[model samples]
Target chain A: MEKIKEVVINNSEDVILARQAAREMARETGFGLADQTRITTAVSELSRNIYLYAGTGRVIIRALSKNLKKGMEIVAEDRGPGIPDVEMALQNGYSTNRSLGQGLPGTKRLMDEFEIKSEVGVGTTVTIRKWL
Target chain B: MDKVPILKMGDTLILAIQVELHDKMAIRLQEDILKEIHDTGARGLVIDVSALEVVDSFMGRVLSDTASMAGIMGVETALVGIRPEIAITLQEMGLELKGVHFALNLEKGMELLQNIGEIFYGED
Candidate 1:
């Protein structure tokens, strides 16, 4: 895996920047238009989550290759209050902030691989990948 | 500060969103459109998103909310020019943007709003 760029998710503008960065990286990785949209949407959701829940965070975009399959990876890390229940958080319609409640699950569905780690009072990190 | 321009045309209002909409900008648009509807007494709203390359969940929600708010104010809202890729991505994300009218282009959107006006105002 090779790092592409890092975007800070401190405000709404950062969320858009993160999405743009992800879309550009995905395009460079040879993703189709639809796939690029999917990746960008996923990044937007995660970055918004970081801004809403964590108050501040960073999104790391990376290019990955394994077995000749190229993909784009995104990692969202935040030091805000971590989710207490990862399972519930991953479930659809489980947002504590009264949003559409589709951020985590929807993002998971958009990407090829999804992983999340969180500890209450510590922080949360969400990683996702989409292959070309 | 970037803002979406809302233009008034007769009894209709047209909003062309040409910039990347951040969260604040989206919220501001909703507020501004509603205010315009009230000030102009416009019964129709046409929102052109043709230039927007990406429509994420946040933006989708804002659009939906804006439509609902317009509906509450007796304004018929028609969203136009959603690219094919955005439609597919929105569908896959499970955001159908229900309750909002759609059109292929600005002309069609205006025609739809005219029809809506006839339906509500019994035609001129």
Candidate 2:
């Protein structure tokens, strides 16, 4: 069965719900254990980033496959001040926020595939993929 | 998230961690804890994680790696109070933490350490 989950995060508290959305979808889709964990970790990192940088956002999880090898796509979007330098943001240990810089780069490293798009004054959207 | 602190009892060092152990804080925390173990020259290192709700692959790997690093520094490390939910997530994530000892709570962890050390200072 195809499943799609969407959750809007307006505060740090919303991050948990966003993560649950991804976790529940992964579990329901019959993905492998590692794939499920990877999805949950990715969601947690991105959701935390949204709260820290944009102060709000939405996490979208969509199951893309149904056969022996299943896959899912996660997209996190926010309407806030976007990153001026995407390259710098991808670098590990480089963070605009005061906390340790591990959110975006770590999230990218955890998933099987990752992509990001951001425009200054527009917003930022991060997409991650994992296959079972 | 509350910051974890280091406790010293005689020659033993106990570090209580009560927050989400993720990438951003892992390096700094590792350096600090290792340095404390080295400087104090403690026989046992106890990590309390009852307050932690989740343990991801990143954090789990770091903990296991730190355990090996502690051995080289002559300190035995023990993990205390890992919640069942955290265990389920770690298993679901296919994360393996090798060589780090664990206990259900801080008190039991201390008892195990005392037995290993052959000190047996009961009733704390």
Candidate 3:
């Protein structure tokens, strides 16, 4: 695995940057247009989560290769009020504040592999992967 | 600092989104659309997204909400030029994009808008 880029999410503008970075990396990692779009859109949702819930966080995109398959990975970490229940938070139609509950599960569906870890007061980290 | 341009063509408003719209800008565009409708008495709206490469959940919600809000204000909205890939993504995300009409292109969008607007503005 090699690190591609890291975008610090401070506001809405950073969200756009993160998406663009993800798209570029996805294309370079050998994803087609639709998969590139999926990767970029997933990054968009997760980056916005950082801005909306955590206020500040970072998204690191990485390139991965295992055996003969090439893939891309995204890691989003935030030091905000974390989720008390990961299962419920990942469930569709579960949300807080202004969200319509599409952030977590929606991103999960867009990516091939999804993992999330959150502690009530500690923070939250979400990792997603897509292979080509 | 970026604003989405909304063009008024008689009884309808046509706006094509060509820039990378951040979250704040999306919200701003929604408000601007409504304000334009209020000021011009436009009964129909056509939003072209042919230039947008991606439509995430946030942008999906923004579009849905914009259509809902415009529906309440008696302005029928027709969203046009949604790329096939974007439609696939939105469906995968479970965004139904309710309360708005979908058209293939700007011409189709305008026709759909006028068709719906007949109920709202035909008396005039």
In lDDT terms, which candidate is top? 3
Model 3, which residues run further than 4 Å from truth?
A1-3, B119-124
Lowest lDDT 10-mer window, candidate 3 chain A? A95-104
Q: For residues B1-124, write the lDDT of model 3, one tens digit per residue.
A: 3887899887999999999898888989999999999999988899999999999878888898999999999888899999988988888888778888999999988877777667655845
User: What tens-digit string does per-residue lDDT give for candidate 1 at A31-75?
Assistant: 998999889999999999999998999999999998989998899
Question: Each model's TM-score?
Answer: 0.96, 0.61, 0.96
Looking at model 2 chain A, report the run of 10 residues with the lowest lDDT sum.
A97-106
Across B18-57, the per-residue lDDT of candidate 2 in tens digits comes to 6555454666787888889878888788888777655654
Q: How far in Å is the alpha carbon of A65 misplaced in model 1?
A: 0.9
DockQ of each: 0.68, 0.12, 0.78
Predicted structure 2: lDDT: 0.75
Which CAPRI quality tier does the interface of model 2 achieve? incorrect
List of clashing residue pairs for candidate 1: none
lDDT of 3: 0.90
